[model samples]
Structures are given as structure tokens and as C-alpha cells.
Target: MYTRAEVYSPLQNTAIWLAAWLYSVESTDETVAALTDLGGRHSYGGQGLAALLLDARASADLSSHEPVVRLILWGPGQAAGLHAGSAAAEALGPAGAIVIKAAGGFSHVLVPRYWDDGVEWRWFEEKKRLPEPSWLSPGEADSLLSRATEQAAVLIEAAGGTRSDLPNPRLTVGTLADFYDTPGLPRGVTPRAAKVLARADRVAAIVETVTDRLGDHSYDPQLFALWRHIRTARMAGVADAVQDYRRASIS
Candidate 1:
């Protein structure tokens, strides 16, 4: 039960909906509607979602059975098992990626790039071999979300509340809320995974909102320490959600 107002990262929405489609939990129409909403949020000029799916399908040639689609999120300290110095690693360094694994050990990684014009999907070469990402267990995911929730509360309190009066053009309280709204989970998602994702999304939204206003506050030693904790927590929560949803899809 997701509304149009809910916002999702391109990779998050794509992985969830596409996995649902792959797992036979959702129809093509449902997946298309979800992706169409995602496309409307961006300004990319590349191939449409359908065309991109077609290309990916053609490239993977997954004829044996439904493939396993996993969402791999990476950042500065987290490589998500990507080999160092590899093209896929370099491309996924900035944002996250979607890995589609077919039969016979065949797979492809789709990295979404955000440019001044819009967003584009970059596919890793099929010949390139990527390491399997280490996924978090249900207990680990729950613990991460719990810590993130606590850290977010501390951050918001240290920042003088969730309301930000800053005048930043790109990031504002309103925009952050809109950008990180609690995404809707696709059908067949496990209850634990759904709970983790919802909590993760809320924590992420709070972290972003508070981080955006950090510039306005004078550099306090305590605030800086709290900032570091919340940032780490946010990253962990996001990564956990990515892997948890994948597990949910396949389970």
C-alpha cells in the first residue's frame, strides 16, 4: 500500500519491485507502475525503464529460471565485496547497485548514475567477476536499526529538534522528508524485512535532515561526535535494508 507521495532511491524501488516480479509475487503491470513512478522522480534522458529492463534481460539471458536480484549499497568505507580497482567497484563507489544473478553463475550489476541532466544505468561487463556480498542476518539487521533509531534521536536532540530553518537550496527539511519517505514494500516481503526497511527509512530520513543543518551549528565537540555515530548508523541501516529485502524476496 504505497502512495505516490512516498519517495524511494532508484535502486531501492527497482530492486524491490523487480524482485517481486522475478519471484512471481507481483505482475508486470504492478512492477511497471512502480518503476514509472520512480522514473518520474528523475530527469534522465537515457533508455526508459522498460527498455532498460529489456536490455538487462537480453544481456543476462536468464532462461533456466527466475534470477536472484540483490541490492548492494556501498559508500566510502563499505565496498560490499566489490573487488578493488575494478570498474564495477569504481562505478558503485558513489551510490548503490543492483546485482542480478542468473543460473550457471552468470550475473550482472546495474549501477545507477545521477548526472546534471538525469540518471543513467551502467551495466558491468559480463566477463567481469564480482565477489559475493556479505549479507546481514535478521538479528544483525534488527540491531542496526535499533542503534540507528537511538542515534537519530540523539542527533535530533543535539540539533535542537527535527525542524530545520536552514535555507539550503538543495537540501531542506521538506525536501529531505520528500526524498526519503518510507517506501512501500513489495508483496511477499517477510515481516522482519519489512519492519527493518521501514525503520531504516525513517532513521535515514532523520539523519539526512539533521546532517543538512549541521553547517549552521557552531562546531561543538559533542555534536561532531554524535554526527559521526549517526552517520555510521545511517550507512549501516541502509546497507542492512538493501540486503534484508533481497533475502526477503528469495525466502
Candidate 2:
């Protein structure tokens, strides 16, 4: 049986809650769009999972862990997979950190304490440190996801969407056409993004593969990595191509 802290730990804060809300967005393009909206509104300290994953150049003290968290929520499609010595694992450590995945590609990560010594804790203590979550539990993840879903639902409805227009069960697709149509994605790339995009053909293939996965009712971690590359390259052509593919999927 999982403990309460294990569940709520993933909630992190309002920012993570917001990210969870966005995660409930089923379409990758729409997910990216919602993330772009969030990045525009928040800074590093408060950046949500989407902002951390999509913006290549954006840096945060805990940004290194984003990939791991991404995998936890998404999949093991990361090229290198999770590295025991990497920043994400180290930050998460063995200190009761856990990742939970559900049907429909919905997932989350939780840690009992942020001050764990696994991720160079000595340095965090000397400079800046994030706080530990005090309100998490084994079964609370469902409620967190629900709350996030409700909030996201309200936002989408306000923008001319209906519950039936979205996906069913675990998550739904929201209206993010306005967010995507907006100009100027933030610039920045992470080391992982550079490696993934190094082979443009591979990146394109992964996009196609993940699209298929979604059609079959699955999620892929590589999809998340691809979005990171798109944000880094600022390749509107690629974004357009993805949007085109999405449109076709529904048509």
C-alpha cells in the first residue's frame, strides 16, 4: 500500500497542479499549446511541467529533474532512459520518491521532501532550496488530477469547448487554438533536446510513431521529448505539420 505522502508529493504546488491539469490534455499539439500558455504566465520558480519540458533554453534550479518527471508522467521513451546518476534521479533519490502511471498516459511524480541530500543537497542548503510537500497521500493523486481536470475544463469551456468535445476517461483534449496561434514561442533548449533533435529524421519518425500510439490509446515519452525539440528549434514548420496531423486524426 502506498502512503499518503507518496500521492500528494507529486502535487508539488499550485504550479505542478497546473501542470497536472495540462497533462490531462490528450492531444500532444494541444498539450504543447497549453504549456506555451503557461510559460507565458509563469517564471522559473513557478514554471509548470509543460514550461520546463517545452522550452529548451529555459533554465531553473530544478529543471534538470523535468526529464525524469516527464518520463514518470509520460513514458520511458527517453533516448537514454533514466540515468541513476543523472540530476533527476539524484534529486528524486531513494528518499521515498515515486512515479505513478495510469491508463491514457496520465501520470505524476512525488517526493516526500525536496531537501533530500540526493541532488547535491549541500548546495541547495547553502543557496536556495524548495520546500517539502506536507499534504500528500497514497490515494490523493486521483483527487489532485480531478481538481486539475476541473480547472482545465473550466478554462476550456470558457474558450468555447464542451465536455463531450474532449477525450473521455483519464483525460481530455482542450481548446488551445488561440494559444498555438499566438506568436513567438520562448527560446531555449536543454541538453536533452539538442541530443534528440540531432537526428531530424529520428525526431520526425518519433512524432509519427507517437501519433500512432495516441490513435491506439497510448502515450509515449518520446512525444514529450519531441515537443522539447520543437520548442528549442522554434520550428514553426514542424509545429504546423503536427497540427496538420492532429486535424487529420480527428477528421
Candidate 3:
């Protein structure tokens, strides 16, 4: 796999992820089908949840470089027991990037640059599940994304998973990136999501540079428009159009 780095955006980030998912699935041996299968697990990555799959793919970027961090209980009470994993991807504020995950009646929020800013993700009313190792269908990516976030909030409110609390949630907990990393990859044929992944890295750089230089300014709509253009071009089978994406991202 190629190296990809990114920071989440408040607007249109999901679309960016779908671009990546579309790219990855295309690269899959079966091209968009691998996302539909979890090998036999209660997975959602392969499910056709539309925006759900897109979000999951975006969340997966959170762990692309870092190892999965456990979201063990951070609060008081047995309600805090078990592995609670809610992964948060931070956007550019006046500060730096942040990633927060909460479950197990608790939460863990981390800012890559500042540990002090890191906070625990607390229980919220929701339900999220990891994509299981079962066989998957191509269309499940959207569902998996939606379900994970939904379950994450519920697990927090429910006080983690059904099992007893673990000393470290990361040990038992898994993220979208982690779930996909587990075991062997199912095989077939694929298109190519690499460009999407590549675009993520480039866009991230653009965001950083823009933020550092622009400072608290509303990003030009053209940036978003460019991103949309990239997505459309890729889906339409015009791989070279990424050059247009590169131009838009940099300037």
C-alpha cells in the first residue's frame, strides 16, 4: 500500500473519502466488490450504505499511519468497563489535527501535536460495531461506515461492550483501518483507488499550507469545487484528470 496522510475537513470531507473508497475498491482484486464483503463478519464496509460507506472510508484514514489506539474506559463506574472504540478524525482549527474515539462508557480524544488537549470520548447514545471477518459484498463500504459511528455513540451510552472492561481498550478495540488490516485480504479483481489516496495526501498538504498562510479565513469555494471535480473525473474513468486535481489542490 502507498503512504497516505490527511486531516479531516468540516465540509465535504466525506466526499473526499468516497473518492478514496472508490479508488481503493477499484484497486481491489474485484474492484469495488471487496468493500462489500467482510469475509463472514457483521461488517459494513461492504454494505451499500451510501454516505455511510463514504464516512467509514474517511475514518479509516485516521489510522492510516498511526496504530489503532484503544478507547478504554476513562470515566468512573462499572458502566465504564469493556472496550469502547470511537475514532475521531480532527480537522484544522487554530491548533493542529485531532482524532477522538469514544466507547465503553468513555472516550479518548487526542491531538497529535498536543497531549494536554487530548480528552476521553465519553458515552453518547449510539451503536457502532467493527466490521467482522466474514465474507463481504462490494456495496457494504457505506453501511460499515455508518454503523461504526452509530454503534460508537451507543456503546458509549451503553457503557462499552458487553464484556468486562479491559485495562487497555486499544488491545481489544479496533478501528476501520484496523479491521481492514486484520487477517488476509479477500481476492478478486479491482480498478484503482490509489489516485484517490494520492489525492488525499495532496489535499492534506494543501489544507495545511492554506491554514498556515490563510489563518481563520473561509476557504475559497473553488477548493471544494476542485475536489468535486476530481471525484467526478475519477469515477468517470478519466484517471489522468488527477493532474487537474493536483493543479487545483496546489493553487
- CA lDDT of every candidate: 0.54, 0.29, 0.28
Best by lDDT: 1
Model 1: lDDT equals 0.54
Across 1-251, the per-residue lDDT of candidate 3 in tens digits comes to 11111232211222222233433423423423432332222122344334443443344323221211211111111122222352332221212221222233222232222123221111122234332212222223223333333433333323333325333233333332233233322221123333332333334334333333223124433233333222222222222222223233345
Candidate 1, residues 92-186, lDDT tens digits: the string is: 74456777765566667788776545567777754555675444554566676677567556656556543456534234544555565434556
Candidate 3: regions farther than 4 A off: 1-117, 125-195, 214-219, 224-251
In candidate 1, list every pair of residues with a backbone clash: none
> For residue 104, what is the lDDT in candidate 1?
62
lDDT of 3 at 134: 23
Q: After superposing candidate 1 on the true structure, give the runs of residues whose Cα lies further than 4 Å from its correct spot.
A: 1-8, 41-47, 55-67, 115-118, 126-129, 161-179, 214-251
What root-mean-square deviation over C-alphas does model 2 reach?
Answer: 18.4
Best by TM-score: 1
Q: After superposition, how far is residue 39 of candidate 1 from its true place, in Å?
A: 3.2
Better of 1 and 2 by TM-score: 1
Q: What is the lDDT of residue 181 in candidate 2?
A: 28
User: Which has the higher lDDT value, candidate number 1 or candidate number 2?
Assistant: 1
